[model samples]
Target: MNTEKFLELLVEELELENPLTLASNLKELEEWDSMTAMLLIGVVSNEFGKTLSAEDIKELTTVQSLVDKIGAQQFS
Candidate 1:
């Protein structure tokens, strides 16, 4: 779960043409919606063995936050 791998997985999940940076805003993505949120929930749960609550999703505004949520340990 290095940062590069996580970013790749995220880009795939979001189906984004542009690469994602730490500053990328989740809400600003055209692909973002309830469906995307649900997809992310599964991604974190299944891939990282981490669960994301609805409240957690609501609080996340940027890609960096997701990295933080899943924890920097995954990268290290």
Candidate 2:
């Protein structure tokens, strides 16, 4: 996916007031709760056709990490 679309989806999923910029930390968001975590996992899986567990989602602390994971899957 393109970076703009990714950021837009991230912003929508996390319910961020500000537009998501590059290298934004997911943990920094006050709305980053368990429900949001689950939503992110679902979004990534659905968008990329990759399965991710809750533990895997928990491991991704930053937006960069999440983008890396998606890119890695794209190449794999």
Per-candidate local distance difference test: 0.89, 0.78
Candidate 2 residue-wise lDDT, 1-76, digit = tens: 6777788987887687877766777878877788888888888888888778877787887777887877854532
Q: Estimate each model's TM-score.
A: 0.92, 0.82
Worst 10 residues of 1 by lDDT: 13-22
The CA lDDT at 65 in model 2 is 85
Best candidate (score: lDDT): 1
Cα miss at 67, model 2 (Å)?
0.8
> Which RMSD values do the candidates have, in order?
1.0, 2.5
For model 2, what is the C-alpha lDDT against the true structure?
A: 0.78
30, model 1: CA deviation in Å? Answer: 1.0
Q: What is the lDDT of candidate 1?
A: 0.89
